[model samples]
Target: MNYAKDPADYPLAAKDPALFVHQHEGAVSWGAVFAGGVGAAAFALILLTLGTGLGLTSISPWSTGASNAKALGFAAVVWVCVTSILTSGLGGYLAGRLRRRWLAVDADEIHFRDTAHGFLSWAVATLFTAAILTSVVSGVVRTGAQTAATTAAASGSVTMEAMQRGNPAAGMNTWPLGYFVDSLFRMPAGSPPPATAATTGSNETPRAETARIFLNSAATGDPLSPEDTAYLSQLVAQRTGLAPDAAQARVTTTYTRLLQKISAMNTAAKSAADEARKITIGVSLWLFISLLMGAFSASLMATYGGRVRQL
Candidate 1:
């Protein structure tokens, strides 16, 4: 009879500890983690680039294209969320399925490990993307700063040349003090006004003064005073060689137009600010929600992938 035919002929391996020894290893697999992270980052980058191209195609520099900023912003938000979900899910699934199997581990422990792998993959991918964006932004900012510096230097040289030509008003048009300086030399109501040649040259003194008055009124959120109106009317009459009543009427009409423009500008600015605030809030909320959803999606997909691998 052969030894294999007898039930008690073979010694049990469990009877000797050395005969069937096992060694446990770490559960975390760096190779799988890296692969998952790189995959997620690449997927995200590709999608983002495609989305940017699509956005650029939709916008135009001229008025002919659809220029609805709100719609564009909304679409961008939606795309970002979608990208997060897709890339995160794929990364998590890859991580789970590729991870080394943990033999003899508890089911609960395996589930926790899968979830951890997914979260870690997402975190690594997010950091990698952030690093790339930061590098790109820093490069752009550095280039812009250099260009601006060069432009400012050139402008400064030209300004200095203008100042050296004995023309006090050469660059005064751009200076806030020019308006106040003009006011200091105002002639009394009954006094003869200065010659047109003296006030009108290339100096732009009167124009600067007028602009300053309008700007000040707008900034203060107040209308021009009666005294200022009268003064401006007198100046207009002297400069235009018109009768007092005609000059006064022209001044009133011009001032009314200016006031309307200022009011419209204020309204537009307020509207822009409100729009920006809303967009900021919306983007923030969407980002948070998308990230939360990405986390959940990643973990769930990871577990599914792991289960499939086991099967």
Candidate 2:
């Protein structure tokens, strides 16, 4: 027995067209759902626009950075919930209101079927809107990636130069290791040289070579060889106009300073990135919860609306 066959052929058909057979009650009612879905989508778009205007009014670029970041995120969440509630509620209610009335069915079945129609309306509208939005988002991301690549190769030189002239206090967030390395090599103005000066007072030969060695060591993270260190001390002496002994001392001190700064910078950057990731996850979780609540509120409201006797 195909269990799904016309009950009229079976022992149960004539008993009551009302009771046992499930012919889907013309219940799908595609036409009504499409209508409701369209209405819902229109409502959703309207709400989205309204939300955007309100959100913009809540933020300003000139305000404190931390405050603005929080405000923008909060405003966005509120708008999302508002859009979901109003649009979904309107769509679901319209679906129930417009569905064809069922014949030969009990009140319970009628109510159940009616509510199902409303839910279907919401589901259909949500899917339609998501599809549209996905295409838009994909386009946006593609453009953003292209722009990022182009700017990275062009205007990025200015930003890189600015960053390299990095503030010892604030801008040090990006590269702690590099910052620390550079810090070790800096010398105070008017300091005596650590090692013997070059034969020419203006020519600091040892210090120049030491700088080359320092750069190599920093780039590769390899400790300087004794020869390299000795060469640097000589250069430091000549550059600072110091005797051999003082130049050697200055060179050693500067080298040690660079190592310490780099280590500290590395740790600070790792910690900051980790904190940002955690904050992002927390916001995402909240958004998910708000979405679910909006859906539930819309569905329950539709169910109630469906029960309203056709005044």
| lDDT of candidates 1 onward, in order | 0.68, 0.63
The whole-model C-alpha lDDT of candidate 1 against the native structure comes to 0.68
Q: What lDDT does candidate 1 reach at residue 212?
A: 54
Candidate 1, residues 178-223: lDDT per residue as tens digits? Answer: 3333543344467776667764664365655565565555455577
**Candidate 1, which ten residues in sequence have the lowest lDDT sum?**
157-166
What is the total number of backbone clashes in candidate 1? 0
Best TM-score among the predictions, by candidate number: 1
* Shift of residue 111 alpha carbon in model 2, Å: 2.2
Per-residue lDDT over 45-140 for candidate 2, one digit per residue giving the tens place of the 0 to 100 score: 788878878877878878997898789888887778777777777877777677665544556876776677677777777888889888999999
**TM-score versus the correct structure, for each prediction:** 0.68, 0.67
For model 2, what is the C-alpha lDDT against the true structure? 0.63
For the record, the alpha-carbon RMSD of candidate 2 to the native fold, in angstroms, is: 7.1
Give the runs in model 2 whose Cα sits over 4 Å from its true position. 1-24, 60-63, 155-216, 219-223, 238-261, 308-311
